[model samples]
Target: MRDPVATAMQVCPVEIATAVLGGSWKLTIVKHLLEEPLRRGQLKRRIPLAPDRTLTRQLRELEDDGIVHREVFDHVPPMVEYSLTELGHSLAPVVTVVDSWGATYRWTIDATK
Candidate 1:
């Protein structure tokens, strides 16, 4: 868990949710993992905007929060994959709502322009 999630006294449900989910690429990562397990390189390609370091950090945080499962295969190159935990899968509805809201917001902005 991140410092804010672990160390701070957050009282609001929304605040606690944000603490766990509000990092730069966190939601996007979760959204992608909702579909299927992916390799590190696959996630990097999917979220090309996030730097490797940022993806790595958010993934670590999510793992700490018990939202994602990271599995390693004993192979010549040590393959790794990431998949959403039961908790992470629970975010599907939230992700769908947010995605819809963002598209509506963009449409609204374009209409005004």
Candidate 2:
């Protein structure tokens, strides 16, 4: 089946970007991954508010999008780690700018309240 959103994104760069990054937790996940590679458990602990299924789904989506790389290590108990790909690393500066904006926005809102 054809994806309408994917088709629309072809004509609109903004739409393509939004489609890739519009999820609630994707950016947050990316932000954490920027620090270093983290195991699934560690990432989940960092994002306690997000449900397990939701986090799993978001991680899968990111992996599909080439924004995240999943590494599986053979050990006594199987270990999986996630890190940003080079394409994903390109978003670090963008995320930093967005985070700065969010902080400023929150500060302004707090001052008014």
Candidate 3:
């Protein structure tokens, strides 16, 4: 028979986790927001290569998943800020692991060589 650990690992595939968080800018957005709340412009500045429409769509998906909270301020410019919901907070540790893995694995690519 197969090992229990192997069976469990296969039961919950990494692809499933990646599917939830693997989009181009999703991890970048999550990493940027891990510390504090941020406005749309601030996020745009943080990840300039990300298209505004794509970012909006991902944020909407996160919000629908109960992992992000959107707050709107009634003001002259109509301020809007996003921060983690309780659910999102639960994801922080998972995100951190992924971040650390990227940090370690990314160095393998020799940019100049």
Question: Candidates 2 and 3: which is better by lDDT?
Answer: 2
Residue 13 of candidate 3: its Cα lDDT? 64
lDDT of 3 by residue, 33-80 (tens): 898899989999999999999999878766765667999999998999
Q: Which ten residues in a row have the lowest lDDT in candidate 2?
A: 1-10
TM-score of each: 0.94, 0.92, 0.78
Which wins on lDDT, candidate 1 or candidate 3?
1
Q: What is the full ranking by lDDT, best candidate first?
A: 1, 2, 3
Candidate 2 overall Cα lDDT vs. reference?
Answer: 0.88
* Better TM-score candidate (1, 2): 1
- Model 2, which residues run further than 4 Å from truth? 1-5
Give the count of colliding residue pairs in each prediction.
0, 0, 0
Query: Cα deviation of 58 in candidate 2 (Å)?
Result: 0.4
* TM-score winner: 1
lDDT of 1 at 111: 100
The per-residue C-alpha lDDT of model 2 at residue 16 equals: 68
